[model samples]
Target chain A: MKRILIGALFALPALTAMAGDFTASLSIAPEWRTDNRDSAYFVAPPVVPVQHRSARQDLGLRFRDGGFNAQGTLRVLAREGQTPEQHGIVNQFYYDGDLGNGSGYTFGRKVISWGVGFGFRPLDVIQREDRRSLNPPPLTGVPLAAWEHFSADKAFTLVWTHPGHRHEATDFRDQSLAARYYRLVDGNDIHAVARLSGRHALEAGAGITHTSGEEWAFHAAALYQQRYSKTFNTLAESGGGILAAANPMQEVMRRNGLKAVLGSQWTGTSGFGVLVEAWYDAEGYSRNEWRRLDALTARQRSLNGMAPASAINGNVAWSSRAFERPNLLRENLLLRLSHDDERWKPALELLVTPRDGGRVITTRLEYQSDRQRVSFGLRFLGGAADSAYAQAPIKRMAYFEWRLALL
Target chain B: MFKNALALFASLLATLIALPALAADDIAALLKRADGYRLLEESVRIETLVESYRGDTLDKERRYTVYIKPGRRSLVLMKSPAEAGQKVLMLGDQFWLLMPDTQRPLRITATQKLLGDASTGDIANMTWSDDYDGKVVDEVDIKGRRCLHLDLSAARPGVTYARIGLYLDKASKLPIKADLYVHSGKRAKEAWYEAKTVDGQLRVMSMTLLDDIQAGRRTVVRYQSIVALAAPDEFFNPAALVRNTLAGW
Candidate 1:
C-alpha cells in the first residue's frame, strides 16, 4: 500500500503537465413534494401509515481543474407527520491526472473499471446511502446490511482505448479499449467497435469483460462479464449472513453476467425518428455448498439464491420535428413505451416553441402501474445567434419530478 | 434595324441569367486571398454586450484582455475584479480554464460543445479563407456607398455558420457589413463593423450583431486597444481553460 501510494504521488506531476484546461459552475434548486405512503417496503400487515408533505432545497457546486474535479451537494428535507425529519450532505470528489504518456491516475470516489474489459461495481458501491433514517427499515438482515454502509475498498480503474477511437473511450470515463471500424457496403456507411475489459480484485481474484457492437441507424451490442472472488469471514460478516456456517464448504461465487442488446435509432431527412431497444441480462451466483444449503431449507433461502436469474427489457421511443422552423422556434414530440418483466412504463412528452428564437414549453406524462408522474415546464432557450465575442447563457426548464420505486 | 435590336436584347437576357453561375467560381478564388493572412499574434481588449428583446431589461456585458499567438495559442487575463490570478489559456487544440479558488487548470476536450450548437472546433482550424468560400456576386450601392457584395458558402460542413455574404466598401476594400447565414435557407445574422486607423493600420474598432432569429436581439463588441505581448507556448494549453483569472471578464 505504501509503495502504491508513493508511486501514485510520484506520477502526479507528470500527469498534471499533460492535462490541460478546466471549467466549473454552481446551481441551487428548491423543490416540494407530497406523499401518502410511509415506506418503500411491503408487509402483510399495516404497521404505521403516514401522510406527509415535504419541501427540500439543495445547493450543488461543481469544479473541475486540470485532472481534478469535485462536486459538493447539500440537501435539506423538511417533512411533516409521523415520519422523521431528514437532512444530509452528499459530497463527491474525483481527480484523474495523467501518469505519463498514456497512463493516468485517479483519486476520490469514482466509477471503477474491472478486468481487461469488464467492469464490476460491487452491490455495496451501488447502494451507498448517506442518510438512512429517511428510508423505512428493511425486513431482512440482508437488505438491512446492504442498506447501511458504503464500499470498503475505494475502487481503482485503469483503462486503455485504441488511439483512433479515443473519443468514444472518454464517454465511459475513459475505461474502454475499443477500435472503431468503418466500411461502405452498397453505398451505406457501416461502423463497428470491439472492446475488452478486465477487473482485478484486491484479494487475488479477477474477471473478464468483452463487448462488441456494430452501429448505423441500427445498433447491436453484446456484453459478457464474469468474475469470482473467494469468500472470507469479513465478507460474510459484511453480508450479514450465516452462509459462512451454513455452507462452510461453499466458496462465495459473485458474478454479473450480461447478454446481448439489440437497439436501433432511425432519424432520416424528415426529422421524425423512432428508437427501439431490447436487452437481456442473466446474472447471479453459484456454489456447490450454497446450492445444497438452499435445497435443504425454504426458510433459509431467498429466490435470488438461485444460480442464475434472467431479466429482459425492451423500450420503444418515437420523436418528430415536424413543426420545426428555420430561425424561430422548433418543436418536437416524443412517446416512449418500456417494459422490464415486472413493470410496464409509458411516457408521452411534447415540446412547443412559439418561434424559432423564443421560449419553449414542455409537458411530460409518465405512468407505471398505479404511479403517475406528470410535469409541465417552461424554459427560455438562449438566443439563436452567436455574438461577436461572448457566448450565450445556459438555459434550463422548470420541472416537477415524482418517482415511486416499488420493491 | 428592329429585327437586329430584338436579337441583341435576347443575348443580353441570357447573359443576365448566367452571370451568377459564372461569378460563383471567382468568388471562391477571392475568398482564398483573405485566407493567406494567417498566423497572427495580437493582444487586444474586447468588450461585449448582449441586449435583451424586452425593453428596459438589463443587458449582459463582459470585458476581456486577450493575447493570441499563432496556432490557436492564447491567454486571456481578466482585469475587472481583484480576484486571484485565474486565466484561460489554449495551447495547440487543447483548452484550459484556471480558477483562483482552486489554483488548478482543467483540461477541456474539443468534443465538448459550447453554447450547445458550436463544437469546440480546433481554434487553429479557422482562417479567413476557410470560413467563407465565395465570389464577387454583384456590385451595388447601399446608402449611396458603393459596395462589393460577395456570396460565400462554407468549404466544409459542420461549421457554426453555413453561408456568409460580405459587403465590402469599394474604396476602403474593407468589410463594412456582413450577413452570416446559419444552416441553409435560414434568415441571416447581420453584423456591421466600424473601422478606424490605428498605428497606420486599418482595424475594426466596434461591431454590432443583429440576430435574425430574434427581431430585436443584438450584441455589440467594442475593441478598446491592442498591444504586443509574448508568452510561453504551453500557456495556451487545454489545461489553461480552467484558469479563472486568465478568463478576461
Candidate 2:
C-alpha cells in the first residue's frame, strides 16, 4: 500500500502543473431491451429481465498539456426500479516522455491492446472481459509502466502490469511482464510477443496482418498458453477437485495448448467491407468432458432447493457456460460486414459453432455526426437446448442508445 | 543498293537516339518546375473535405487534416464522420494508425484508405520526384494551350499507384491532370487539379477524382487554410500524435 501510494504520488507533480488544462465531457444513454426467460431463475444480472429499462450516464475529465496527461471516467447507472449506483474508473492516465534515441515511456494506469484477433482476441490475456453484448463494454486500465522504441521498420515494446498495486502474496517479480517485437515486411506488420505471468505460466504469441493491394487483406494470430492457469471455463469438468466421480489432477494442466485465429478482409469500391474468420481453441473441453460437466450441473440444480449453500459450493464449477471459454464450443466461424459510407452505417456480426450449430447474430444501424451518435441493435441467440448459446438466459434482445457529447 | 540502305539506317538510328535524350532533358525540366508548385518542405494545417457522388446521389462526405513534413514524417487526424479521434503517423516506411478507442497503434500500409478516393499516401506523400521515374511521352494542345504528357513509374513497391500518367501545362508547368494505374495495368482513377494563385504563386486549391471501376462515382477534395510552417521533431513522434495535446496543435 505504501509503494502504491508513492507510485500514485509520482503523477501528482505532473498533474498539478496541468490542473487548469482540463476538459470535461458528459453523455447519457438510456436503453430499453427485451428478452424471453423465466423470471424465477434469473437471480442476478449476468442477464437482465425479459423486459428491462436502464439509463447510463458517463462523465469524463481529461488533462493534457505540456508533458503530462490523464483521463478519468465516472459512470452513473440506474435501473427502472432499482437504486442507482455510481462507479469510477480510470480509462488511461499516463505521463509520456521521450528518452531520445528512439525510446519513450509511459507510466500510469492504461489499457493495452494486444492486436491478436479481430473480434475475439484470446491472447488478450491481461483482461478478463465482460461479455454481455457483441461490442462489449470497455475494460478498465491497470496500473503499470510501459516503454517502447522505434527504429526504421522495427519497434519494441516492454510492459509491466500490476506494478505497485498489491496487498499480499506477490513481490515485484510476481507481476506480469510482457515484451513485443514488431517488424514491417512488404508493408505488412509481423509481431511476436512473450509474456511471463505470475498467475498464468509462460505465454508466447505471434500475429501477422497484410493488405494485398487495395481490395484484399489477410491476418493470422496464435498463442500458446497453459490450461486452467487462472482461466475459468465453467462448462469444462474441473480437473482439480477430489470427488468420487472426479479425477485428481494438477492445478495447471500438463497439456499446454494453442488458440489461433485466421481471417481475411475484403473491401469493395462501393464502400462495403466483409470479414470472414475461423477461431480454434485447443484447450476447449472435448465432448466427453462437456457431458460430464453437464451431468454435474444437472445434479447441482436438482440439489439446489434440497442442499445447503455449503454443499452447492462444494461443486467444482457451476454456472452458465455462456461466458465460458472463448466460444464455449470448440470450433467457431465468424462473418462480419460493415459499411463505411456516412448515411446510416450498418454493421453485422455472426458467430457460428459448426459442430454444435449454435449461432449468435448481432446487427446494428448507427448514425454518427461530429458530436453525437445514435444506434439501434438486436442480438439473437439460437441453438439447441443443450448447445452452447441456448444455455444463456436470454433468447433475444433489442436495444437503442443515444449519446450526445456535452463539453 | 547496300550503300543506300546503310545511309538510311544510320539516319534513322541517329533520330531515334536523339529523341530519347531530348525527352529526358525535357522531362527533368518539367519535373523541376512542377516541383515548385507543390512538394514543399513545410507543414500545412488544412482541412481536406471530400464529397463523393454516385450518379446523382451524394454517396459519402467527410473531412480530415493531414500533417505533412515532406521526407521527414507524416501524420493524419480524422476530424469528422465515423472514425473521429483516430490519427495515423508515418516515419520513413513505418506507419501506425491509432484508432479512437483502442490502445495500440495499428500498423497500416501507406496505400490504406483514409476517406473515399483519398488514400493515406495521397495526403501524406509530398514529393514525387524521389519515388518516381518519368519521361515525357507526347505533346498535346487543349483549349488553345500546349500541354506536356508524361508517364511515371514507381521505383518501389507498396506505393499508392504503380504507374501514373501526368499532364502539365507547358507555359506555367502547372500540373493539369493525372491518371493512377493499378498493378493490373487498368486505369483505376483519374484526378484533375484546380490551381489558384496564393501569395503570388500557383497552388493547388482542389482535386477532383473519379473512380474508373465505378463510373459516375467521383470524389472532390477541397483544401482550406493551407499555410507553410515547420514542424519540430517531436511533432512527428507517435507518442505526441496520440497525445493530441496542444503541443501538436
Candidate 3:
C-alpha cells in the first residue's frame, strides 16, 4: 500500500517531534463462520468462498520517540457478499540506534518476537508467529537489520531478517539470518535460535523458561528445519488418480524438519489459570500422509453417479486445502483455562489431534477498561468420526471486539 | 548434681541468644525508620500516578516509570495509553513482563505480581528494610495516632504481600497504616499513608489502596516524581527488558 504510506509518513515526524510516547486505538472486529455441510470436504458451491460474515475497522497507531518507533494500522474492510475495503498497515517502523556501552541497533519494520511456547513456538526463528490465529491482526513487521547486546543476565540478538528479501516461499517471507541467545541461569529463562533461510535452509532452536513456586510455569521448545514445505494432493501423492482438471495442490519438499513444544502453567492468586501444551510438527500431516489423503478422499467419494459431478466437486475442493494447515496433525494438544477478573477476562481452549482424533474448541471473553476494550469469541470443530476435525470444512467460529483508546 | 544441671543449661542458652539479638536490633532499627518514609535514595526514579476510585466515581488512570536499584532491583515503565509498551522487571523474587507487541520476556509468578491499578507490587516496592522481618507487635491507639504495630513476615517468597500489618508513626517513625496480607491470610488491602514536604524532604507522597476484597475499589497511589536515579545495570536485565528505552533517563 504505497509501502504502507511511506511507513506512515516516516512516522509523522515522530508524532510532532518529541514529547514521545503516543498511542491511539479504535477497533471493531466482527467475524462469524459456520459452513460444514456434512464434510468429505463439502462442496455444493465452495471451491473457496467462505466469508460468511466479516467486519473490521481498526485504526491503531503508536509512536515512541527517543530512538523513534512507530506502529500503524487503518483497515476498514467488510464482507459477507463482499465490497467494502480500505487499507494501510505498516505495523512497525523502528529505529532504535544507540551504540554506547551495552550496544543497540534496530532499523525499520520491527516486531521481532523471539518465541517460547504458548501454543507452539518452536523457537520462532524470526517472527513466525501464528500461535493459533483467530481474531488476529496487527503484527506485520519483518524487514530487519538488528544488533543488540546486553548483559547482567545476558542477551544478544542479531537479525537480518527479510532485509533485501527474495527467495520467499514462506518461512514468513524468507530471506533470513537471525540469531538470539539469552540467558538468566539459575532462575532459568534461557533461549537460543538461529536461522539462515533460502526458505528454511538452516534453522535451529532451543528454549526454556521455568518458574516453580508462586504458581508454576514451565516451557520448552525445539526446532530443526533444514528444509520444510507441504502442499500435496497431486492425486494424493501419485497413488493413482481419480479426478483433476484444475487445482491439484502440490508444493512438496522435505528433509529433516521438526518442531516441538511442551508447556505447563498454573497461575492462581485467585485469578485462576492453567495451561498444558504439547506439540510436534514436522510440517504437519502424516498419519501416513493422512491415510493417503483419506484414501484419496474415499476414492473421490466413490465416483458418485459415475464421475462428472464437476469431477467430484473439483476433487473434493482440491482436498480442502489440507485443512488450511497450521498443524492439521502431526501430534498436537493444548488445553487452557483462564480467568483474570478485574474488568473480567476469561478463556478456555482445547485442541488435540493425537494422530486422527482431531478437535479444536475455543472460547474467550474480555472486558478491560480505562478507555474501553470488549471481546468475545467462540470456536469449535470436532473430533473423531474419522478426525481431521471431523472431516472439516469449517464448523462454527464467532468473534466480536470493541477496543477504544483513541490516544 | 551434674554441676547444677550444667549451670542451668548454660543460662538457658544465654537467654536464648540474648533475647532475639535484642529484638533483632529493635526490628532492624524500626525497619530503618520505616525505610525513611518510602525511600529517599538507594537509587530511585519513581513518577507513578495510578488512581482507580469507583465510589465517588473516577474509575481508572495509570502511568508509571519506577526504576529503583540497589540489590532488589525494579523497573516498571508502562505509561498508560492503556499501558503503552508495557514492562515490569523486578529481580528479587524474579518477575518479568514486557508486553506491548511482545519482544518476549514473560516469566511472571509471585501471583503475577498483582498487576494494574498500582500493583507492580504497588509500583515497584518502595522499601521495607529489604522485604520485611517482624517484631514490634503492638502499642496501638490508631485514631489518636500513637500506633506502632509491625507484625510483618515474608522474608521473601516472591513477596507481594504475605502478611504485613505495619502501622508505625509512634511519634514520627512515619508509615501510618497498612494491612495488605494475602496467601490466604486474607485482609487484602487497606493501606493509607500520605505525607508531604517534598523538595525539603518528609516524602511518602500518597498511597491509599483499600479494596479488602473488592468493596467499592479505591486505589490512589501518586508520587509524581522521585529522582535520584541509578538506572543502568543493564536495565535490570530480563534480557534487557526488550532493549532498554529508558528514554531520558
Top lDDT: which candidate number? Answer: 3
- Per-candidate interface DockQ score: 0.12, 0.19, 0.26
Per-residue alpha-carbon lDDT of model 2 for A1-407, expressed as tens digits? 33433443355446546544544445566666554343112234433322377777666555665657667767777887687777776777778777877678888776666655676665565543423254344456667788887665567878888875443243223467888777767667787887777555688889887766556778898888753332233334554332223322223343477778898888764567888999877655544555555565556556766766444433332344223445666578899898866446798989887776778888989886646778888888776566556655556766666655443
Write the residue-wise lDDT of candidate 3 on B1-249 in tens digits: 999999999988886675565456578678887788788888989888888887878877888888888988888887777667888898888798988876777887888777654578877888887888887755678878887778888887888888888888877789988898887898888888889998787979888998978888888998888888797788788987776778889
Q: Ten-residue segment with the worst summed lDDT in candidate 3 chain B?
A: B16-25
Cα deviation at B93, candidate 3, in Å, is 19
| Candidate number that wins on TM-score, 1 or 2 | 2
- Compute the lDDT of residue A380 as modeled in candidate 2: 84
lDDT of 1 at B70: 58
Clash pairs (backbone) in predicted model 2: none
- Displacement of residue A230 (Cα, Å) in model 2 is 5.9
Name model 1 segments beyond 4 Å from true. A1-53, A61-70, A80-223, A228-256, A259-407, B1-29, B32-128, B197-200, B221-249
TM-score of each: 0.45, 0.76, 0.35
**How high is the lDDT of residue A75 in model 2?**
75
lDDT of 3 by residue, A203-322 (tens): 888888889888998988888988888898988889876888888888888888989898899999988889999989888887788788878888899999998787887888888889
RMSD of each: 17.6, 7.9, 21.7
Candidate topping TM-score: 2
Q: What is the i-RMS of every prediction?
A: 17.1, 4.5, 11.6
lDDT of 1 by residue, A1-407 (tens): 33433453355445445433322221222232222122111111122222224444333333455555554433444454534333333243555554332234444543221111101111111121211111111111001000001111111222232222323221222223322222223222223333443331111222211111111133344443453333322322344432222223223445644434344443221123344443332322222322222232222224234422110000000000101111111121222222221122222322222222222222333332222223232333333232100111123334344432110
